[model samples]
Target: MSCVQTIQDYGLRSLGFGERLLPREGFTLCEQFTLIGSGIIWNVYFGALALAAGFLLATVLAVAKQSHNRWLRKPAEWFIFIFRGSPLFIQFFFAYFLFLSLKGASSFFNPFTSAWLGALIVLFLNTAAYTGEIFYGALRSIPKGDIEAADAYGLSGWTRFRRIIWPTMLRLAWPAYTNEAIFLFHATTLVYFSGFPAWQQKGDALYYASYFADKTFNPFVPYPIVAFYFILVTLGIIAIFGAVNKRLNQHLPQEARRKLRIRPQVIR
Candidate 1:
């Protein structure tokens, strides 16, 4: 088939919207690119939803961890510790089985056994833990003078937090948090490879790349395509985060601003 025909057939195969059957024989370069690109849809879905949800939880976690009350602090501390201390792969593995067991208890839990929900849950909690620590450090790093300034202005409680503490925490943590966001997207590839099974051959970019590699017995081509797609993803992430970083630092002069430095994590 022509490349255009191939695109039409497999462009959305990963979403189960296009051709149901994967290309069987004599796979061409167009087919590989098209199918793999389609699979990237899932990666974006998992990363975007997980990152957005994780941000809110991370904020709460950071506040809880900073609380003097042990009741609030201890659970937050342990939650972050458990998720961060263990490898994410193990989390996905155990989460699948845990959900599977819960499936017997209620029909509502049925969706949790699938990658769509189960894997997303794992990603959400994992990123929340990592980001919570980042925000906690930022909270601790807030200048005592800033707190005093807020107090002098009669700012206290939620007023202080909303006007001073929260924005300052975000500004300080953003550079590191940008790195976390990038890493989280990269980590989404682990979803299908982990215990969560891709139903009906619908999978992520890595899943399709692996399929082509196994079928063609040539790892070089499809694997590099996966990398290319992710590189584009990384670039898109950098662009978006960089804009946010700029806005966060807009109050300061350009030279005094803390520019975003993406330090990709080699080990997590």
Candidate 2:
């Protein structure tokens, strides 16, 4: 079949459009590309939503963690430690099961057994913890001179934080936060493979890739397609975060501001 025809058949298949049944046998390159590409929608959706929501929560957690009061600081500290210390894979399993058990409690909890809500919750918390740590470190490292200047100018409490501490925290935390964003995007793939079942064969990019691999016993074709899509996504993320990072540091001399770097440390 022509490439166009193959895409027409399998494209958006994850949404229950186009072909109702996936290719049962003799899966072609075009089929793999189209199907996996269709699956990329789910990945993008999960990553975008989780990351956007996590950013605000992370800021709150970071500030709370740095609070002088033990009541505020201790909980935030333990939260960051627990989530950051555990493997994401294990967290996925544990979260899925925990949600599963909660399903019987209410109708609202039932959605948590599915990837949409289940995976999103995990990704959200995981990103929050990582980002919180980055922000917390940045908070501590904010030059004392900056705070002194803010105080001297009669800035205090919320005014001081909004004008001085917040911007500095963002500037210092951005590079590491960019790394966390990339890792969170990659981590979205683990959702379907974890305890949550992909209802109606609706799965993310890695899910469809793994499906093709199992069907044809050919890992080469499908996995590479998934990887290529993820590379594009990773680049897109870098471009976006780079723009934000630039804006955050625009006040500083070029040499004083550090460029955003992608360091691949394990999240947990």
Candidate 3:
């Protein structure tokens, strides 16, 4: 089949919209590219949704952890510690089974068994803890002078945080948070393998890549295709974060702006 035809057949195969069955034989280059590329949609879906939700929860957790009250601070600290210190892979398995148990208890908990809600919740909580730590550290690192200046202007509490502190914390933490995002995106590959069934083969990029590798007995072709797609996505992520980083830093003096660089070491 032509490349266009291959795409038409498998472009949405991961979503089960096009090809009813993946090619069992005649795994042409076009098909490999098309299916792998199509699978990236799911990866993006998982990463994007998880990151959006994570950021909101992370902000609240960060503030809570920074609070002076033990009631607020200790719980946030424990939550952050538990999630951040553990391996994400283990968290996935634990969450999947926990959700399954809950599903048995109540019908409203049904969605928790599926990847959409179950796996997304795991990713959400996991990333929130990681990102919350980042934001919490940034909150602590905010210049005392900045807060003093805000107080000088009669700003306090919500007004002070919303106007002076929060923006600066985001700006300071964003590069590291960008790395967190990239790591989280990479981490989405663990979802289907965590015992959450793909439910009609609608798995992410790595899922389909592994499937093709297993079927063809050729890891070279399909795995590299996954690598290529991931590299492109990593670059795309860097670009998007770079734009946000730029905007966040634009208010700073020219020399004060830190250039966004992908630091994989932070994740490790």
lDDT of 1 at 149: 100
TM-score of each: 0.98, 0.96, 0.96
Assess candidate 3 and give its lDDT.
0.88
Model 1 Cα lDDT, one tens digit per residue, 24-141: 8898999999999999999999999999999999999999999999999999999999999999999999999999999999999999999999999999999999999999999999
Candidate 1: misplaced stretches above 4 Å?
none
The residue-by-residue lDDT of candidate 2 on 105-180, one tens digit each, is 8778988888888889998998999899999999999999999999999999999999999999999999999999
Q: TM-score of the candidate numbered 1?
A: 0.98
lDDT of 3 at 158: 90
Best by lDDT: 1
Clashing pairs in 1: none
By TM-score, the best candidate is 1
Q: Worst 10-residue stretch by lDDT in candidate 2?
A: 259-268
Candidates, ranked, TM-score = 1, 3, 2
Better of 1 and 3 by lDDT: 1
Q: Which segments of candidate 2 are over 4 A away from where they belong?
A: 265-268
* TM value for model 2: 0.96
Single out the weakest 10-residue window by summed lDDT for candidate 1.
259-268
